[model samples]
Target: MYEFCPHCGLKYEVEPGYFYGAMFVSYAISGGVALVLGFILFYLAGDPGGWVYVAVIAPAMVLIAPVNFRFSRVLWLHYVAGIKYQPEL
Candidate 1:
């Protein structure tokens, strides 16, 4: 993670432990993914065995982790930290 934005020199971490909230955001994202996947598996796939879910959803979560991590922090920064986008800046 960057300590500061390269383009604008704004600190990524606005305060001590500011990113801690991002963890919850990430978890929520993960849970939402899992819930949607589970719903699909249950309805579309006829609720395959438990191991099928483990095999599928586990890797899916892992695969999305990088995107989830970044997006969650960005959301936390914009939505929670009230950092507005300034394209002119």
Candidate 2:
């Protein structure tokens, strides 16, 4: 990623470990996905085996990781870092 925002020239790396907080956001998103997916699988699949959950959920999480990663960072940037979009920039 760029060290600073190309639009407004805002420094994205505010500190040595600024993005660490994004991990929590990612965790929350992933947890929610797993929980909801679990419910769907449990009901739709008629209470499948534990291995079935692992087989499906693991790959789903892996497939969504990249999107979840960027989403989490964007969320953290807006909510936690207070970064806002500026069309004028």
TM-score of each: 0.95, 0.93
- What local lDDT score does residue 27 receive in model 1, on the 0 to 100 scale? 99
Q: Write the per-residue lDDT of candidate 2 for residues 1-89, one digit (tens) a residue.
A: 78987767889878889899999999999999999899999999998999999998999999999999999988988998898887886
**Clashing residue pairs found in predicted model 2:** none
Instruction: Quote the positional error of residue 50 for candidate 2 in Å.
Output: 0.6
Assess each prediction's global lDDT (C-alpha) against the native.
Answer: 0.95, 0.91
- Model 1, position 44, has a per-residue lDDT of 98
Cα TM-score of candidate 1: 0.95
lDDT of 1 by residue, 1-89 (tens): 98999888999998899999999999999999999999999999999999999998999999999999999999999999899988987
Scored against the true structure, residue 41 in model 2 reaches a CA lDDT of: 96
Off by over 4 Å in 1: none
- For model 2 the local lDDT of residue 11 reads 93
